[model samples]
Target: MSQFSRLFWIEWKKLFADKTIRKVVFLVPIIYLTLFGFLYSEEKVTNIPTVVVDADQSELSRELYRGFDADETFGLIGTVPTEEEALRWIDEGEASIALMIPAGLEQNIKAGRGAEVLTVIDGSNMMISNTAVRAANTVVKTISAGATLKKLEAQGSWGDEGMALYTGIDFRYRVLYNPTFSYLSFMVFGLAGTVLQQVLFLGIALSVAQEKEQGTWQTSVATNSFFAITASKLLPYLLAGTLNMFIGFTLLLKGFGVPYAGSTVDLMVVATAFNLAVLCVGYMISYFFKDQLQSTQIAMMIAVPSFMLSGFTWPFLSMPTAVAAIGKSLPLTYFLDGVREILTKGHGLSAVGHDLLVLAFMSVVSLFVAYLIYTFQKRKTAGTQAESTIG
Candidate 1:
């Protein structure tokens, strides 16, 4: 017990005893969060550029233009006389969408014959296209519905029963968790997980590999029991990683107002489990490579692809079979999936049960592999009988 305590303190001392580890683990993540927080500060996109082509030259066309102007989503650029002029605005990137009212639209509507309104939307950018398309559709749908109801009233059909003949069903949708559909709230949580995984992996990987890089393990820690040294090293990082998780959660929930709908205990458990899995993997990586830079290179390389493959920004199911199989093997992929459900959908432990089990199994399997590598290396080093100048 005393030996364990001494080894633990040595591990802690070694960490603060170096400046680089302190900065990378503590300061870098905070910097990342602060910069990313601003990206989503304004939770929505507004005033999307739109244009109108009013060939009708009548009251109906003018009313349609007003509707587009009134919506916060659409910022009407200018009215043009021809389809060619409106198409030019879209091609030049001046407008995201355009509504064209045909010349005889008002005349056809007045005569109880429906008129076609052409809507041209830029499909290149999904984000802008989604908002612009919805706004345009709303304007068209509202006007058409009002005109149809009026025509029915004029023909002596009235009330909900009469309207049912024209409209089969009134489908009302309720957005439960994210009522406002703020994109910031959606993105912040996903990115928080991504950044956390990268930093923690790097921190733990560097810890083990750096000792060999600086020759400290040969002179100092090599005298210590192998299990004690490994345990002591892992404990410090586990604690630090857990604390970092809470700090990240605070920033996302308290700072950015992203919802935290799951049990606090559940969040902590998952976070700690994820940290252990990564730390175990880090140890395996540290054992495989002889140099600190080499371990970090491998880690960062894996880190780059982890986010894309994690099903956070993209759907895992939609990915190619081989690519998605690679993603499924990663710890972050499962953690991100569970985090999304717990934070956004307010799901409990049962909801994320499969992912939780997979994460725990990953941690156990990695720890076993790391332990085997550690013992095998220790045996081989003893067999080598290599003399160290520092010792």
Candidate 2:
């Protein structure tokens, strides 16, 4: 075998030779994918416990309660006499959603003064809030429409013309992207990134650090320059990590029926840039630490927080300024949102221009950092060798 081929196979074998490394590099990612996949496997959130306070004491309020009970997303737990009690239930963890049919609600509707149903929901858990608010809004709208139509019919207005007269300025809206509104579609991008980042960081961090520990850094230095060694060390991991991310995302979309309506070319471009940035950071950490364990820890430092800060689950605006600024430094904060826009929003390259530019900048910066770190490592290694020779 040629030198390159021999070295490549050696790197490949190094992955499986250690049973602990094998499990961490492969099995941990799979475990996270399947576990999180199953957690959000249900496309829509359901059975969110809810409580209602009926101050109206009218047929309309009672009818509205029945509607909420019949809706699959909500389960009517109990009724309270006051809105304060309803709010207390939410705060006490007894309910996730609450409603108060205000006093004189039916009277106002009957007199054409307009009625409003006050909905108080715990916004702490975003998924539950989304599901509860959506379901509750549907119930309220349905009740209002049905009652309006019935009242108009009594005045000899009926059918399409009556609906048109009463329903002027209709509040119809479109989801724009994520037509199905599947949770899997919402979370798939972040999950795929989570798995990819973990393995890539773990694999690349261990690459040079393990070699240095085993006294093979000299062999690598003898054969190649610092840049060449860094590239060679990362090549096997880059290929495997890229392939693994692609297959994982493919299965996530196909198996779970998540929607993906975007250009494959766009996805490939962003994925490659993100992979490069992450691998470079890992390589920098690898050269910074001669111990594999310390290198792995440093590389993984960003892994847990990246997903949370990536604007995948949480809005970047909601975070503190310093935290948000730090999040922007990570390639994932841009990549996740960019990929999501492409897949869910049906955005073209032009639409995600800012995201692409940020990722490109990160790739360049990380590569430069890795090269500088490698240079420092080389100089330090040389100084240590000379000192030992003189002694």
Candidate 3:
């Protein structure tokens, strides 16, 4: 066997022998996948509570109130005589939206004048605000159209002319990809990629520390080529990362009925290249640091910034130009975009060619730097040993 191969085997064996490393490699990914997967599922956010204050005391107004209650999007939690009571419910967090119909609503509608129904919304929760606003608007439009048609019929003017005027234009809305706008479909894919990155980084960081802690790094560096040593350390992590990706995508994503329209082979290719880059980064970090605790602290610090700048949680287009430019410099940013395009948009290799090339180039560059650092550290250790022998 080659000197590097034997050294690599020794390092690999040492890594396997550590119980903490073994537990971390298995547990971290599973925990992340389970936690994020369930949190982003479609079962969340089914109904929002709302209070209604009906002062009109008219059949038409009562029908409108019933319409809001009947809709599945909202649950009519309470009926109040005064607007003050409804506001109290909102302040207490018992309701997300409050509907107030003034006393003269039916009187104005009967006189052929438009009546206003005031919708009071709590803006404290952004998701609740958006959902309440949309549901309230839909209820208002439907009720108004129905009331108008009824009034026209009572006046003996509900003819084809009235119908034509009432239905001025058909507004068709098309929701692409996820027609139902299921949150699970959108979030699961993102969570899967994120979990993969975290596990891969943590695994590599710990792997390097194992060598340092066991005092094997000095011996391995003296006997093996830096490239060979780095590769040997990286190989197991690459396997672990790839396996984690497959398990997350299959169990969490596909099992939840999220679409997997992308080319599997292409995703694997990109993921493999990305994992190698991450492994090299881990080795480079190890060369600079000596212990597992320091490595973990540095890894976590690096991960938080890398994840934030990756454009997964936040859109790159919405950020300031300078901030966006800096985010684009991160490798995770490109990898995330490529993963999203391939998995969500079903984009081909040609579309993600630029990102793939960038990842490949980064991997090569990082590996070379790690090799050089390892070589330097090795020479330093050897010179110290020679001096000690002379003494």
Best by TM-score: 2
Minimum summed lDDT over a 10-residue window in model 3 is located at 167-176
Lowest lDDT 10-mer window, candidate 2? Answer: 167-176
Counted clashes in each candidate structure: 0, 0, 0
Please provide TM-scores, in order, for all candidate models, with all chains considered together. Answer: 0.56, 0.58, 0.57
The positional error of residue 375 in candidate 1, measured at the CA in angstroms, is 2.1
Against the reference, the lDDT scores of all candidates come to 0.70, 0.72, 0.70
Q: In model 2, where do residues sit more than 4 Å from their true spots?
A: 1-173, 387-391
Considering TM-score, where higher is better, how would the candidates rank from best to worst? 2, 3, 1
Model 2, span 1-391: residue lDDT tens? 8999999999899998976678778876775575345434454667778888889888988888888889988878999998788877875557867877778887778777756787777553456666666778888888878877778878887777674854211222223244345666677678788878888888888877888899988666644686678668778787887788678777877777677778867877778777877887777667677788778766776686678666466544345556667677887877786776677655677767888888777767777887787666667777878898999
lDDT by residue (192-285, candidate 1, tens digit) is 7778888877887888788888877644343566568768877899898889999989877888777667776777778888888877777777
Query: Candidate 1, 214: how far from true, in Å?
Result: 2.3
- Residue pairs with colliding backbones in model 3 are none
lDDT of 3: 0.70
Between candidates 2 and 3, the lDDT winner: 2
User: Cα RMSD (Å) per model?
Assistant: 15.5, 13.3, 15.4
